[model samples]
Target: MIKIDDYAYTSGLKDVHPVEKVSFALIFLLFTIISKNIWVACFTFTVMSIGVLFKAKIPFIAYLKLLFVPFVFLMTSLVAILFSIAPIYQEDLEVLWMAEIGLWQIYISSYSIQQSYELATTILASVSCLYFLVLSTPLNQFIWVFKKVKLPAVFVELMGITYRFIFVLLEKMNEIYIAQSSRLGYQNYRSWFSSVAQLIVSLFVKSMSSAKELQIAIDSRGGDEHLYDVDLSMGYNRGHFVIIFFSFITLFMIYIMTKS
Candidate 1:
């Protein structure tokens, strides 16, 4: 099982209706994006963090590791936006700091840096909304909710197949790694590169074979026509409804404040 699914199934809120989780996450996500305020985004992240850790019971270390994935990209992108180059001092400007490299100059603008911070916070907050939802609800349940809304059968089927095959691909890659390592495939830097390249080629071939096998298995199980007919019983959680109600109210207030 995928690690994320593992957590989802074990989540404290896993038994709640997925629609509740979906709507709650989406509401905050849209609010965070539209508000365009760093404080609002930070507040959104905090609330989701509370839901994930206290409500969902996901480990803090795991959450940190997940945030690290996006933080790396955010920092790399921020470098470009926060810093600018100029030829000497063309005009009087309010810069946070400036550095002279011989005839050229590089400077960080206070206003631009402030904008970057808010943008990063907004993006990370929006991402966490989905992350919190995914962390609490299994993919099958999520897909079931989409089916409830009448999402196209072809697209839903593709999503299920793509998700199912990710583990298959990873398994194939692992087997190839073990085989190569046992035969001294990564004894040095030169061999390590060769081993990785070979692994990629082998994994590609195996993925094709895996897809074919999966299709045959699916056909044997009465095909994709009945895929969405699986039992996905959902029960309403009154507490979830109340939480979402207040969350929307709060977001509305924040939106008005930001506009003002």
Candidate 2:
């Protein structure tokens, strides 16, 4: 998670207008789902992967590790879908195959495999689109774009606070883990579990303490309701917008032809 934020801050495309990136990511994401075409899914995944690896300069190994997580889950779900149990199998049944387990039968229909493949690719493509957005645009810039559109101050404030606090929580968790490791807290399974439970309790107490300190500090400074106000200079780039617009248009046209 920290590495994701780090890449967003140092991305080569960070200088580009956040709105343009947002528009591109969202538009393509919608098309990827709506088209419901395997080709479109492949296209969307390829485009976003290229942008993340080449344009955003994320390391290839790191990107693979990120993708490996979802890929494993996808495969697991697909495997689960490829089998089912019934009380018995009819000799005239039209299933691809079947196996007996005592008085029960386990089998998979061709439709289940087809549906799983379609759903898995669709999920992968949509996730890739989101990955592109977050990797290229940090939370600050994302909130800045929302602020530009005059979103409610309270909503923007919550988003900013939530994002910042995520990093704070991660930092605190890391510190506790390192300290525990140094003390042989995870030398055995029993000790590891105890250490993890303590870590959670300790983190909660620390977080509450920090929040109280922050509240006192803010109260001292007369409190801030509009604290999310940040100045960012972002201009709409017609060239980037045009490229994205036409790219999706062409992609849709191909979908139409291939779909028919």
Candidate 3:
């Protein structure tokens, strides 16, 4: 628990509110949609990297590794799109393969390459921003920030309970699996499947009981009125809004200037 708390609260992004982090992320997405220009995307990425260091105190290399997993699809898509949209060579312009719509024909122009490169970079940069945001912030803080944004109370409460219980269920499952494995209960494939099936059914029953108990506990403590008693503050400030607003403006200008 201590280790988990340390990882959660002191991971270099504790000071940034979840809403601001999400807002910065949305700006990245907007940039991606507006321009496929490589230079603009690179500029946005560089700015975002510097901002991460200043605002979140995250080491660039550490966060880069965390982002690698989410970027795989982006990288693959960029490569495929770049190859598909790239212009044909002057000599190869007339060289057509068997008739397939849009596949064999090439435009053979400088603009094609520029457009494809721009699009690829925009996607990659946007994906990187989202990945960094998630790694830097804690899950609980996300829900807290959502409450202030006027998210439905029932939805928030349900999400919170689900998030809290998922870890609990994982812990219980791990204990059961370890004990069974130690006793050679999973020596055969069939036995392992059966054991897992039984474990899931058992977990479901326990979760249902736990939910009932939680409902009872809440009812005993004043139920629907509980949200009125809880303090939810919309903690926006000028600095936060200004930073986001300017970032959006700059990115929008870049998009307009470079877009095909």
Candidates' C-alpha lDDT = 0.86, 0.86, 0.67
| After superposition, candidate 1 runs with Cα above 4 Å error | 217-226, 258-260
- The superposed Cα distance between candidate 1 and the true structure at residue 189, in angstroms, equals 1.0
| lDDT, model 2, position 240 | 97
Candidate 3 lDDT by residue in tens digits, 161-200: 7877877777778888897888787999998898889788
lDDT-better candidate, 1 vs 3: 1
- Model 1 RMSD in angstroms: 2.0
Q: Which stretches of candidate 2 lie over 4 Å from their true place?
A: 90-94, 221-224
Clashes of each: 0, 0, 3
Question: CA lDDT of 81 in candidate 2?
Answer: 81
Query: lDDT per residue, candidate 2, 1-260, as tens digits?
Result: 99999999999889898888988898878988888777888888899999999998988998888888988988888888878777784565558888889989988888777778778878898988998998899887898889988999889977887787788989999999999999999999999999999999998998888778867877888886576767777777889989898978978887988794
Write the number of the candidate with greater TM-score, choosing between 2 and 3: 2
Query: Model 1 Cα displacement at 248 (Å)?
Result: 1.3
lDDT of 1 by residue, 182-246 (tens): 99999999999999999999988888888888779889988845554545777888988898999
Q: Rank the candidates by TM-score, best first.
A: 1, 2, 3
Query: Superposing all C-alpha atoms, what RMSD in Å does each candidate have to the true structure?
Result: 2.0, 2.0, 5.8
- TM-scores, in order shown? 0.92, 0.91, 0.66
